[model samples]
Target: MSHEEIIKTTQHWLEQAVIGLNLCPFAKAVFVKNQIRFVVSDAKHLDGFLDDLDRELVFLAQAPADEVDTTLLIHPTLFPDFEIFNDVQALADDIVAEHELEGILQVASFHPDFQFADTEPNDIGNYTNRAPFPILHLLREDSIAKAVEAFPNPDVIFERNIETLQKLGIAGWMALGLQASQK
Candidate 1:
């Protein structure tokens, strides 16, 4: 698929799955405020993708929070394997630490086949991190800290998300039209 199509699909998933299911309580705020940057990377190699990621991290760090609070660096062609994606995610996190952005920035990973360590492959909870393509969600640590502070019981977000997705089930999730992109 083309980059535009990938972005549209990713946006649709964000609307119908992430926000629609309330997986992320903070997502709607940034999304509605148009503070989320959706970047589609066309890099076919890992090195090129890492370069793009580096650029995005720098861009987000330098940009004003009001103008760009978060970024979804979507990679459509690279890291199709979830394991490889996870490896790259680790590298990205290392980059953040190396840049001394440990408290200033963070990276959240997502993939079409995202599965938790102990969960079954088809577990509904995995859907919480699933997206149309491999994505490194770059977020401002300060924003996350503030959001968590304002949110009640932020520590229970993972369990809450699991409960929410379990209630939704595979059938309900399929109804959202996200499964089509995975295939």
Candidate 2:
């Protein structure tokens, strides 16, 4: 698919699944303020993808939070399998530590198939992290601290998300149209 189509699909997933469902309470603000950066990776090889990732990590680390609070490095076709995506995610995390941005930045991940350990592949809870494609969500730790400070009981977010997804169920999730991009 073309990059525009890829971006549009990713944006649709962000709007319909992430924002519309309120999966992330902090997301609405950044999204509304246009502080979220969406970078589509067209790398056909792992080295090229890693290079792209490196650039994004540095850019996010240097950029002001008000101007770019977070980034979603989306790879629509590179990671066709969840396992490969998960492996790449580990490398992405390692890059953060290697860069000495351990305390300043971190990498979170999302995929069309984001199964948690001990959970079935089709578990409703997995929908919480399901996105249109493989996405490395680069975030600033300070932003997380501030958001958590302002929000109540941030520790309950995981449980809350599971409950929210369960309540929504597969039917509701399908209605959101995010599953259309599923591999």
Candidate 2, position 55, lDDT: 96
Query: Candidate 2: deviation at residue 53, Å?
Result: 0.5
TM-scores, all candidates, are: 0.95, 0.95
Question: What are the per-model C-alpha RMSD values against the true structure?
Answer: 1.5, 1.4
Writing each residue's lDDT as its tens digit, candidate 1 over 1-183 gives: 988898899999999988898889899999999999999998878888988988999999999999999999998868788988999999999989877889999999999999889877787788899988899999999999989998988888888888988888888888889783252
TM-score of 2: 0.95
List model 2 lDDT by residue over 81-133, tens digit each: 88899999999999998889999999999998888889888888888898888
Measured on C-alpha atoms, candidate 2 has an lDDT of: 0.89
Model 2 residue 77 CA deviation in Å: 0.7
**lDDT for model 1:** 0.89
Task: At residue 70, give the lDDT of candidate 1.
Answer: 99
The per-model lDDT (C-alpha) reads 0.89, 0.89
